[model samples]
Target chain A: SQLAEENSWALSVHEGESVTVNCSYKTSITALQWYRQKSGKGPAQLILIRSNEREKRNGRLRATLDTSSQSSSLSITATRCEDTAVYFCAGMGYKLTFGTGTSLLVDP
Target chain B: EAAVTQSPRNKVTVTGGNVTLSCRQTNSHNYMYWYRQDTGHGLRLIHYSYGAGNLQIGDVPDGYKATRTTQEDFFLLLELASPSQTSLYFCASSDPRWGGRAEQFFGPGTRLTVL
Candidate 1:
């Protein structure tokens, strides 16, 4: 069983468009993290929201955490081709559990 | 900028051969971790260490060995590699600052192919 799972398998958007990827988890967590992995690269930390915080933002990326629902979402605004990557939401309890990931493809 | 780097950006090995993946972090973080990424499974933790000379078992630690030699270096050892071990390996470091609210910084990743 997976501890964290994302909503969409793949998403495509044109430049200047906005896209949102949702995620859900099964157990309690201390923090939730959003990571971006480009092609042939390792995952890079985008945001880290604690259980006490509801929302966080970094540049054009926004992340929201809902502990009550055991879910999270990552939204990208003004999308560009460079923003195309696989996004994963991870739950950090004693250890880290990652979602399957949502692949975002941005067309220019 | 603070970063974590992994050696042997790409590696190809035969089955039953020995493999050693090295990682180093300049962020001076306390907690280090090793994970492997597959196509469908995303990332699964193989092992971790809090500091020098400490090893912690992760969810999937069956056929892997790890060593934390210093504050900056952590190594993953595969004594007898198998085809199943073919995947992208990542090393990360996390500073437990801000009441354990800090995020983990990952390395560039090592792509290993076992034949």
Candidate 2:
């Protein structure tokens, strides 16, 4: 069974706009990770938020974790065309269980 | 730089044929995983290994077998391939010591077609 699932299957926005992807999990997790996969490429880790940490930021990317709700959110500020990819949220426990993913398209 | 490489980037085989997918990681991580990605199911773990000579069944381990012969090498075997098995396969490695932040490094992925 999938432990984590993204709220949106697809999302579109202007290049300069900001976007947020929400994810919810069903079980307790040690941490939640956000990953991005470009066309024809493997997924790469974007941000990892621990259970104890409510939020984390890296450059224009911000990730928030709400353990009380078993939910997480990833926000990208000033999106770019290069940001077009599929984003996934993974719940970390004994292993990483990935969500279906959100396909984000940043139109120039 | 740590890296993972998979051989036979693309493959085609007939039903009941045997196939082996190879993965090698230079990261020397203790955990190696095999996952398959389909249209709507996203990525599902097929098998995993924590060390050489150790194998753990994943959520979807049926019709698949895996062996970790060495710290750097992990192989997934399909003895009787079927069309339903056709999908993109990925190999990943991670160090458990990183705690909750252990980031899995993935290979480019192998595209397999079972006709």
Candidate 3:
């Protein structure tokens, strides 16, 4: 749960700009997942990166995992206002633990 | 698409009151999980089940109990609700056979308020 923590509490960017949310975990993880939660909805998985791989991508979303540093990052390219949401990074091994989350506001 | 639904989208209960949140997933996934989300703390797992009649403890299980009656239905019970338990609850289901259960289908979520 608290083992994973996001670096920033919030960030703001304009439309068409790219933004990244970072996370660090206290323990080993087999995989790292980035999830996005919009207002009034549950969190949805965006991308999953394995420890063996350095990066993974889905559509406009990209995820990178650095097992050696116990860190991960999710980057969104050409963000839209609809992309505004709380982003969380989850560490998955025997159990799945989520980071606090970084709220990203994409301004028009 | 995988579908998961939760009942009583909003709930308000007083201290010492009892509350139960219902969830049903049409995904036919074998694993279901219950989690609570709050400011700063993010999502903390309360409980989970691999199948019917099987339950597993999660990160935060002190004030909650859960039961999986069938493959599709899982219920979370709060016998004595407290203000600290006031948070958004979400139900999710996934199949372990898929890339270590990375992708989970989640319900809309139940907003619980305890006074």
Q: Rate the local accuracy (lDDT) of all candidates.
A: 0.90, 0.94, 0.90
Clashing pairs in model 2, backbone N/Cα/C closer than 3 A: none
Q: Could you tell which candidate, 2 or 3, scores higher by TM-score?
A: 2
Error of 2 at B110 (Å): 0.4
Identify the candidate with maximal TM-score.
2
* Candidate whose lDDT is highest: 2
TM-score of 3: 0.96
Top model number, DockQ: 3
Per-candidate TM-score against the hidden true structure: 0.95, 0.97, 0.96
**Ten-residue region with minimum lDDT total, candidate 1 chain A:** A91-100
lDDT tens digits, residue span A23-78, model 3: 99998888888889999998898887888999898999988888888888889999
For model 2, residues A17-94, the per-residue Cα lDDT tens digits are: 999999999999999999999998889999999999999999999999999999999999999999999999999987
Query: Which portions of model 1 miss their true places by more than 4 Å?
Result: B98-101
Worst 10 residues of 3 chain A by lDDT: A89-98
In candidate 3 the C-alpha lDDT for residue B115 amounts to: 98
What fraction of the correct interface contacts does each predicted structure contain?
0.59, 0.54, 0.71
Q: How many backbone clashes does candidate 1 have?
A: 0
DockQ of each: 0.63, 0.61, 0.71
